[model samples]
Target: MRYALYFSPAETNPLTKAATQWLGRDAFTGETFPTPEADGLARDTIHELTADPRRYGFHATLKAPFELHPDQTEAQLVAAVERFAADTPAFDIPNVIVGQLGRFFALVPDTVYPDLQHFAARVVEEFESFRAPLSDADIARRKPETMSATHRANLDRWGYPYVMDEFRFHMTLTGQVPSEYAPAMREELDRRFSEFANAPLTIDGLALFIETERGAPFTVHRWLPLAPVSENRKIAS
Candidate 1:
């Protein structure tokens, strides 16, 4: 079973209910309990992804999926995550939007936020000690021949191609929207998210997600609050 630590807003906030409805038992929707839409654009963007619940849903990835290291156990991984969460205080992400990134659709951060990206990188880096190096087959499957050298390098080092330089913080809403609906879909998403068209989105915590087998859906294992901690009060530093 592969496990990933994630950050899920639906688990804590009421504004994500509509998104949970759209996702049903897949992806982000299943892990997060039902909630209402925080912003109109969030509703529309999530709705489009849920249009095909079997495939898409809304949620951000803190740790990309990976198996436990040969010497590592699940309990150890969980403990590591807990420690990491404890050390890192929570922070907010400013206004998000339903934007088009190339040919795909996703909810993106409109502002240039270094903390969000840094947090993601920290997750991947901190937990790396617990991660097993990807097998050749795993690498092959994750990295296609069409991938560029830069992306391939990212894959070899980080186990994912779109990290660091290529990373754009987004919670994917759909795979590939059929061309015919592209225009109208974009319009609807834009109109719907207009309420939060520029509203700040707070990232208050972290979530742990699990997939036990090949055909299983991810479920939430833990939710850690990202709060401030006074360094001076540390037990040992």
Candidate 2:
């Protein structure tokens, strides 16, 4: 089993509901959904495009999946997360927009937000001790040869190429959309996520997601909300 630290809104949140419908699966409930209707896209095409994100569920990955370090226990990690959540103040990203990362798509902040970057960095650093080093197979899967020197170095050090300075926060919405499909996919995504895109997204909680085995759909193991700013300040004082 492997675990990932991710940011996901509560299951009942309207944003979550819309993303869940668009992606056709609920990471929190393990339920499958029919592909949402789109004017120019067939259900099969929509499902094909979403296959990758569907397995992972709807989330912005903070820490990529990793096995526990030999000396660490899951209970210890959970306790650490609880304590971390209790002390960190919640914040928000002012606007989110549908943006493509290479050929695939995701919801990204319209502008950089330092608090979001710092929060993500903190998660990576805070949980580093719990992450086992990447095995040769895992490293190979990341294809170090194609990575730039910095990304390769980061993969070597963090077990993920996109952490720290390399991280660009994104909640992946699809697998690679073929060049032919990109325009329509973008249009459909905009239509489907209009209520969420270009609106503030609260960074309220950390979700612990687990994969029971390779290729299995991941599911939320816990949803830990960050304490309010006032509460955190009081605790600190």
Candidate 3:
């Protein structure tokens, strides 16, 4: 199995519920939800648009998926994740918007937040020891030749092309939409996610997701909250 560190809101969070419904699958429950009707789009069209994101579920990736290092045990990795979550304090993104990334659509921050970047980078760096180096097959799958020199270098060193400076936090909502379908998809997304637009999104926790096989749907193994260490100290005192 391959493991990924992802930022997932609490299961009860409205955004989480809406996203899962939009994609027609719940990562937490491993259950399929019916796709909500969109006025201008056919149900099949919406399903096709969301096919990719549905497989991965609703979350922003922090540390891209990897097999654990030979020296590391899954138990150790889980403990490390729990420890990291307990020590880290939560923060919020001032605003989020439904935006298109190339042909795909996602929820993206309206502006770059330094704290968000720092947090993502920290996740990548702190977990490097637990990541097994990417296999040659994995490297080829990324199509490094099409990537820029810097991205190729990042893949070599970080095992994923987008990390550190290259990372742009996005919670993907759909796969590539044809140009003709893009406008309708955007409108539907805006209507469905309107409450979240310009709203503060709390970065409260991280989740561990596992894919049992190469093409299997990823499921949440655990969700850990980011409780401030100072809060624990205060309670103890």
lDDT of each: 0.66, 0.92, 0.92
| Candidate 3 per-residue C-alpha lDDT over 1-237 given as tens digits, one digit per residue, 9 for 90 to 100 | 999999999899999999999999999999998867887789988888888999998999999999999999999999999999998888888889999889989999998899899999999999999999999999999999999998999999999999999999999999999998888888998999999977889999989999999999999999999985476664764
Models ranked on lDDT? 3, 2, 1
Model 3's C-alpha root-mean-square deviation from the true structure amounts to 2.9
Alpha carbon lDDT at 13, candidate 2: 92
Worst 10 residues of 2 by lDDT: 228-237
* Ten contiguous residues minimizing lDDT sum, candidate 3: 228-237
TM-score of candidate 1 to 2 decimals: 0.79
Tens-digit per-residue lDDT, 105-142, candidate 1: 66788866888889888887888887788888988787
Regions of candidate 2 where Cα sits further than 4 Å from its true position: 231-237
Candidate 1, clashing residue pairs? 15-36, 15-37, 16-35, 16-36, 17-35, 17-36, 40-192, 41-192, 41-193, 90-226
lDDT, model 3: 0.92
TM-scores, in order shown? 0.79, 0.96, 0.95
* Model 1: lDDT of residue 184: 62
**Residues 8-126, model 2: lDDT tens digits:** 99989998988998999999999999888887788999999999999999999999999999999999999999999999888889889999989989999997788788999999999
